[model samples]
Target: MMKPVTAQDLQTAGFVPERRRGPAVSVAQATVDAIQTMIRTGHLRPGESLPPQRNLARDLSVSRATLREALSILATIGEITAKPSGRGFVCADPGEKPATPSWRFAARYSLREVYQFRHVVESYAAQLAAIGHTDPELAELRECLQTFRRAALAGDISLYAQADFDFHHLIMRICRNKLLVDMHQTFASILLESQRLPTERRGNLMHAVQEHESILEAIAIRDPEGASYYMRKHISMAGSRAGLPLSELP
Candidate 1:
């Protein structure tokens, strides 16, 4: 008879470990890795429902919030499907592709329109930020970039989404144009959703992270043209990743 998998088995596989001070992996990410490992190893079979959240969290030695976040990432990437009536999550078949999340504002705006608007506004914002940013603003931008990179590396989609928004919003603020900042803030949720959409598709996020680095380097060096150019490139590439063909982008 095969040995049954336990939390201890996950721990032995290095998916879960004892809590420590500032460990390399976030607790939530560690939990995500643990569950994915279970699915990959056939311990968590396709269509099998996961244990209740409270029980699973207890077994994993992670808080409910951390477990929820991990589960959210898994669902976003289509590793698991959430059942109705509070039934809990079920593992997906191996190699199944994640469904693209529906755009909530599709009735009001198409993705191509959003990307075109972003390309125009954000690229100009990047140029202005490069010219007008103070040292402290630049420092904050660098911090946001680091946060984005870390979140991408960890595969924490929620964190990555926030970091991506923060980086772009910070650049908008640094541009020091009241009208531009007001416009960005007015459509903030829509823009943040746009940032989140690309992450739902299973792929290496490092490419986007590298694009962010290019924008940051240009801003750090106060090269307005370079900043604008990179920002345009990044937004265009992001649009492509979100299923907007390059030809459709402005």
Candidate 2:
């Protein structure tokens, strides 16, 4: 049998050390940030119709119910307006500034419920990626690893941050689950944004490398249960560092 992935392997791969700390951002916060960043980066441009509910949930690695909550949160802030329940959300410019107090309040108030929905869906996605990832998709995981290592070696915080973010994205792709990938896509930048907020520069990235390597190993060996366990652990570690529980949220 292949040797289980080890911390040494991760270190040898040039993983950066990281410390974890912060107020756990809710799923709504993550979703809102993603929409903001996409506009900031011009990925969605102006007035783009956000993807359908099912599609958004799949891309963001979240549950449909959880994503709906995020949408409600967004609507409160005037970032996107969707009519009634079950309609699509559309992009609206927040102008030159970040969202106003009303929007911020929605995000702050909805924190617990958001996490409750997200953790459940993310746990499920972990299980799916473990089972359905393809070989090319597997290679993407390695590429993310190597890029992160290079960024760490160069002491490039900005680059390391972006790669670290994409690395998680690769995991969803590796799982070959469209729904999961969609869900993850929805919140892509928000996690990074949260990390930036406290500027918590804990040597926490190394722990992540080791954890990711473990997940990859299970996938390489075609062990679904092992893969799922590791994936959930990985998301949990990040959340825990952010001062949130890894299991079901409140």
Candidate 3:
């Protein structure tokens, strides 16, 4: 029988408990990394139930909400599975591969179709934003990019998703085109989901962050063509990360 891993085991494995004051996403990511380290070092073995959430959270010096978010991310990536009784999570066998997430909107729109639409509409929005964005709008976009980078570095997919949405949505608004903004607003949920799909599939996000930086640099220089080109490239790469081949996109 696999022994249950206690919080003391984690502490002894160098999982230092610290009170951090910042975005909960970063804190949650620290929790995720600590748990992963414990598992990697054999303190938490496969099929072992984790310490109860209350005790674990207290030991980690993180809020319960932050701990829950970390656990949820671990579950999503197949590092752990929730117990049948909804009590706590258990470590997955290291040999077991994580399952790929299925597209939930396949009945209405194909993934290729969605990426194509994003490539067309969002690239144009970037072009327009490059020409029309004001100083304050550029500053806001820069801030959004920074947030996205931070979330990506911390491996906080949920926060990264929001930052990704805010970055593109800001571009739509900066374009000052009511039709474009309306279209983005109408399809906000779907767009956000599309953004999340790639992150869930790929472990590293710094490449996408670099792409965003290129796109933003173009926009900051008021180069509409460059902005449009970089946005197209970023969307293409994002699609490829989500299992859609660049050759398959139109």
lDDT of each: 0.81, 0.56, 0.81
lDDT of 3: 0.81
Task: Summarize candidate 3's per-residue lDDT along 84-105 as a digit string, tens digits.
Answer: 8978888988777435557788
Candidate 2: list runs displaced more than 4 Å. 1-118, 195-199, 245-250
Per-residue lDDT of 1-250 in model 2, one digit per residue for the tens?
A: 2123244433343322222213454554455455455545555555677767776565555567766655654554345655447357566655632422121224543433444544565556556766777778778878888887777677676877787768766766665678777867876555455333211422334555676688778777778778767766555444434434223333
For candidate 2, give the lDDT. Answer: 0.56
Tell me the spans in candidate 3 whose CA falls farther than 4 Å from its real position.
1-99
- Which 10 successive residues of model 1 have the least lDDT summed? 16-25
Q: What does candidate 1's lDDT look like per residue over 150-242, in tens digits?
A: 998899999999999999999999998989899999999999999998887655587689889999999999999999999997887677566
- In candidate 1, how many clashes are counted? 0
- Clashing pairs for predicted structure model 3, backbone only: none
- TM-score, cand. 1: 0.61
- Arranged by TM-score, best first: 1, 3, 2
